[model samples]
Target chain A: MSQIDLQKILNQIEEIQALFVFVQRVIPYLEEIIRFVQETTPLMEEVSQSILESSKKMPTAVAELDKVSSTTESAASDMLDGIERMLDTINNSISLIDQINEFEKERLMKEKALVLKLAETLDGIEETQAANVKQALDDFYEEYLAKNCLQKLRQNIFCLQNDAYEIMNSLQIQDITTQQIMAANDLIESVQSKLVALTNRLSFLFSASFNVDSSQVKIPASMSFNTMHSIQDINNDAPGKTVETHDSEVSTNEHPNVDKIIKPAENSTCPVIVTKEKQRTNDVNIEQDHFLQE
Target chain B: MQKTILIVDDSATIRKLVRLVIESMGHHTIEASDGLEALSILTHTRLDMLITNLNMPNLDGFQLIQQVRKKYHKQNLPILILSSEEEPEIVERGFNAGANVYLYKPLIPWQLRQEMNKIFTQAKLGRD
Candidate 1:
């Protein structure tokens, strides 16, 4: 080959050498990138599997939440029902007190009339005895002494009338007891209403949290939205009304809707975590309802 | 006619008070500390009327009334529930369980007498 051709060959050899060096330098980086991809492939698969497992548990978690919410609402409703029953009992007791008070008042009035008549009769006796004693004073001193005894007897009769008055006044015990019981009943009813409101709010919160409907939750019939709304309306209309009046309104019956209140466990939309013992107890309650209906 | 009344209560004071009131009404009162004792007495004695308290040991008034209803007709043998429990449900239960009348505790003397008289009158009418 000529010298010029030798030079061109030398240049080509140098270019090839540079290219080879570049490839050699890039090869390690490519291998590192390949290694990194290989390592992350399993990690991506593991992440995808974890996401799939979580997605599978979503419905189960929601179900559990719904169950918990239902249980809590049911328990609260039951407690509210129990408190309402107690309030009804208190109101009945108050009614008894009123009846007793009426009876006692009538008896006292009758006794008072009788005692007044007795006083009138005693006055007549005293007047007659005095006139007779005055007429017989000169003829019979013993009769005068007997007149003194009669006067003392008249005073005793007056004292007896006063004792009767005192006895009549003592009937205030029933009044006071009645008032105390009414106050207690009012307090209990207030607590019940507050509990009802709280239960409603809690049910609403739970329903919202679980993305469910509040109306679907099984609450006491007396603590239903309509009942609460009515109570609120009453309160709003008559803010000055006593708690006793409010209590009277609510405690007039054991449950506003007796049939609705009977089967709360069965009416729940969510799963109830009832034990075997609780199930048996519920069965008994159902049997009692049947018996009552029968 | 002096009727025999069985007064069942847990409190001795209440029993005694009831007995006194019943006796004053010219009725004979048999006392029992609880429903069980009352039941035992009932098994042996002939009672004209039964007055029971709702809250009692051994057996509650509800249970007693239920048991008594199994044997006695409401009209034939009168059962009066005299209890501190004034729940409408309980009252309803008492009446359902063959009770003639339900009277609440701390009862007025005359009111109780009136109720007793009413039951006795009913029983007499039924017998006639």
Candidate 2:
């Protein structure tokens, strides 16, 4: 409107030139950011997928092992019952055989007198059949069928009772195995809870930093995974209850109770995320390199 | 005299097996699955001895022994540790907790019988 403002017009042109140069400088950073996201997305997803799969599979594994322990325990109990019955039956049989042997001994005394007199008369016979009959009679009389045969039967029955007891003793292995299974189940359960916690933390951090769809990696509410669960909870308490783990008693007492381990006030940017920018850090420590802050 | 002994172990099979051996010795036995249950039994039952395992949930053998020794004399309610635990430090801890004797698993029946007899005999002799 007034005289031509040549200096102002020239300044405006210079500003436009500077804006173009700044945009040109920013293009490489933008491309790098795109490339970084393109490369890192799959790796982060893979890690998340691994944690998710492990958390899901851990409980099933623990359940199968628990079934094995309980089934074997029941089987062992049944075996012990069978052995006890065998011992009791064999012991009764031994007592009965002892009584029969005593009765045979008395009868054998009378048969011996007759056998000796019969042998004296049998000595006069020369026929082969008669000699065979005489030989059988001597064997029967001398062998004392009631005492020798019946007493031998009793001894064998007693041996069987001892064998039954031996089997009963060997079944103690089940107890050792049960303890071992419980320890293993506890360790697995512990790892599962820790995995779930870690997965949740990582999913939150990744979604906040890189806009990753956390829902894919984060376990749903249905999983309801809790820490410190154990398979030894015959007490029928809650899954995360203190009554489950054997060593939990000591550990729970040692740790102070907390309402929540860590919770954010709201969804916010993680300070340590660098967003694919070049930077240098003097702090070698990972946490304080408070390193990703660029 | 017939002494009443409390058998404390998490394993039901072990409890039953130990019960049989104790009963065969002509003494009575009471059973509990853990130290907490054993402590409850000790509150109301008059027991002459306690036979416990080292490893268990809720409360372990050493803790139970310490609690028992606090309430009863070391010799009054004689504590015996029967366990598969082979660690010398754990065994020593059991003895330090007021255990009167310790026995290992897979011990022959006659050996257990003899040990039980020795416990009773020693108790009798101590009382006399």
- TM agreement with the true structure for every prediction: 0.35, 0.62
Candidate 1 per-residue lDDT, tens place, B23-118, comes to: 657889999989889888988889899889887779988888888878543346778888766678988988887788888766666788898888
Which parts of model 1 are misplaced by more than 4 Å? A1-294, B72-75
Pairing residues by index, what is the TM-score of model 2? Answer: 0.62
Report the C-alpha lDDT of model 2 over A1-294, residue by residue, as the tens digit: 434686776577457445534543444455455456657877977888899998899999999999998898888878877876776678678878877877777777667666656766776665454566667876876765644677677778878877877887888999889888989999999999999888898788677765644222221111111322321222232222121123333122111111111111123111111111123221110122222121
lDDT of 2 at A52: 92
Task: Report the C-alpha lDDT of model 2 over B5-122, residue by residue, as the tens digit.
Answer: 9999988778877876776577999999999999999988998889999898899999999988886444477788999888899789889988888998854677878887898898
User: What tens-digit string does per-residue lDDT give for candidate 1 at A224-252?
Assistant: 21222223222232221211113225532
Instruction: Categorize the docking of model 1.
Output: incorrect
Which prediction has the highest TM-score against the true structure? 2
Backbone clash pairs for candidate 2 read none
